[model samples]
Target: MKLSISRYNPELDSRPYMQDYEIALVPGDHMLLDVMLRLKQQDSTLSFRKSCREGVCGSDAMSINGRNGLACITPVRTLHGTVVLRPLPSFPIIRDLVVDMTNFFQQYHSIKPWLENPEPPPEKERLQSPAERERLNGAYECILCGCCSSQCPSYWWNPDKFVGPAGLLQAYRFIVDSRDKATDERLENLRGPYRLFRCRTIMNCAEVCPKGLEPSHAIEKTRMRMLHVEASGELDTHTPPAGRPSITN
Candidate 1:
């Protein structure tokens, strides 16, 4: 099998290029990541990220045959011809097939993905009823692999302002958690034009998610919550202070 992988080194090359490698496919070899590992064995300088070899880690996400997905889960045999591999689009390339994820994580952090509750802790851990827990099923499964967000046109245009599908999915995750005490505050922080409204419902996020999670659905739920807040006359009170950073589209 032949793999044409994108190669880039900011220190050495001004732009990215492709390099081809031929690997002898064995009976047990199936996944694209396995093929990459075989290629790396021949050229030790080839760089990429992988962890857990399973798709759970989401670290091996890249453009495979012009689609965004986790290489760890993609079967190499499913690809008909020469395979083309590239880093996740719209991110700073660190090296061959490795994109810098600093901005991706920053957007995640901006949403405060953790549960926020200022109330005193209970004797036991905070627990949710089964029905409440079910609300998080789709939203909580996100592995934070760059696939969905990298494929999003809105995020590509407003990378700095829009939190993107992964962040918004997590935002919905916390927003719907019955135990979280900061639902209102979370909604307040995301009230800006780009923060929550930039999602055009293009469905690219849901289409490329390796986990089959529907980030667009979660985004819609968040939008409904914002509308509910507005209709209830609750939006005026939580206006951010003057000179506060505004995330606009």
Candidate 2:
């Protein structure tokens, strides 16, 4: 099998390059992650990020044959020929196939994933109705693989402010959770330019999600909610965020 891999070295090259590796494979013997591990074993210097080879860690996230996926979950036989593995299209490449996730985390923090409350939960497992828990199917399914954000144009242009797909989905996650009580505050934070307005409904985030999460739909729902709140003349009095970009059709 022929594998094309992306290469980068800050000390030597200004940009990245593609390097090829050839390997022999047997049936049921070569998953993409397994192939990558083989390469690493052969040449320890070869770089890539991976954890939980079973696919839950979301660490081995990369683009294979122009499609974003969990490397561990993708099989070698699935590719027609000459498999091309690249670091995600966007995000600052840390090295070879590893891209820095600092920005993704920052955006995620903007949404505040932790459950906050004015009153403490009763000393028992907080229960949720199955219907309520599934209210935001799109948001609940996000695995934080960064594929959605990496493929997003908004993130490509403005990594600093645009919350990107994963973050927005996380926000939507809490905004609709039955136990969450800060929906209005969450909506207020999204009132800024970098918030809901930045999404173009490009659907790129949904297209590349490995878990089939539809972040685009979540963003759209949030946009409509924000607009309705504003139209109701019930919007809170606060200055619009500075340096926030506008979202246009």
Candidate 3:
């Protein structure tokens, strides 16, 4: 396999450069992460993040052949020619394939990802109908991989002021929750011109997401709810079914 990976060392080199390597792929080599580990054995200085070799960790996200994806799940067999690996685009490079995600996380934290319900809790637990629970399906699967935001042109321009796709997706997750009573506050917080409206609906976020989640759709739903086109309340239309109490209650 031929690999061209980005290499950077702030203390030693002033600029980053692409370093090439050729290695034989063994029969066990299935994913890009496997090739990376084999390369690391030859060069101890190579740096990248990987955890839970499955796709859930979101730690191994990088640009593969100009497309952002997770190394843990990208099949090596699908790669053609010299595979190019680079850090997430537009992010500050910490090292080779590792980019500083401080700003990314700060934006994520700004949205308040946790549920907010100021109403008095029921004697046993807060409950939701099956239909109400279904609202969370597409928005709740975000893995915070930074792939979507990194590929977004809007995020690249206003990373500081704009809440990126990943953050807005999480914002919608809580905004649609039936038990959450802070829908008004959440919408108000995102009412800023740059924070929510900066998104150009480029659909880059949906294209790069490893989990197949659509942050663009979630953002549009949030915009509609803010405009009063959709109801933003504790949608308790159906009777609650007998179920286990929520641990978050």
Candidate 4:
């Protein structure tokens, strides 16, 4: 099969380029990552990231056929012809199929991903009712692969300011947790023109998530919760002018 993989070396080449390869598909070559491994044998210089190879580590995420996905889970048989692979889009390329994830991680860290409860700790782990726990269903499955956030155009434009989908999904994860006590503070932190409101709900984040999570939905839920707080006067904010749509919209 013909494969076009992006190649780059700061020490040698000035810019990125695609290098084609023709490899014989072997018996164990079931996923895209398998082909990548075979190609690696042919050219040791080819650079990429892979670990766990089970879609859990989320290390092998890249742009396959113009869509961001984890190579470990993408079936080779599902690809058509001349499979094209590249680093995640709109990210600074560190090398072939590898990107600088510093900005992505910075936005993620800004959300305060862990649970916050200043109240007295429980003797055991904090327990939640079954229904309360169920609120975290879709938000808890994010693997921080950078697939959703990298594909988001808002993040592409405002990588530093926007929390992006993955971070927002993580933020909502703690916000809806029954055991968390800092939901208001978490929402307040996201209060700004760019941080959370920049999401256009384009659904690209939902489309490329390897874990089938809906980050756009999570972003919408966050927006709704913010609006609820604003309406209740719980947050120090002003009402929108008459006949003018609120920025939260």
lDDT at residue 8 of model 1 (Cα atoms) = 92
Residue-by-residue lDDT tens digits, candidate 3, 158-199: 999999999999999999999888887888788656888888
Residue 201 miss distance in model 3 (angstroms): 0.7
Judge candidate 3 against the unseen true structure and give its global Cα lDDT, from 0 to 1. 0.89
The residue ranges of model 4 lying beyond 4 angstroms of the native Cα positions read 239-249
lDDT of 2 by residue, 105-217 (tens): 99899888867677777899667899997796767767788998999887888878889989999988888888888878898887777656677677888998888888988
Backbone clashes in model 2, listed as residue pairs: none
Superposed by TM-score, candidate 1 places the C-alpha of residue 90 at a distance from the truth, in angstroms, of 0.5
How many clashes does each candidate structure show, in the order listed?
0, 0, 0, 0
List runs of model 2 lying over 4 Å from the truth.
Answer: 28-30, 237-249
TM-scores, all candidates, are 0.93, 0.90, 0.90, 0.95
Regions of model 1 farther than 4 Å from truth: 237-249
Choose the strongest candidate by TM-score.
4
Better of 1 and 2 by lDDT: 1
- The residue pairs that clash in candidate 3, if any, are none
Better of 1 and 3 by TM-score: 1
Whole-model lDDT, model 1: 0.88
| Shift of residue 62 alpha carbon in model 3, Å | 0.4
Q: CA lDDT of 205 in candidate 1? A: 94
Model 3 Cα shift for residue 81 (angstroms): 0.7
Model 4, position 178: C-alpha lDDT score? 91
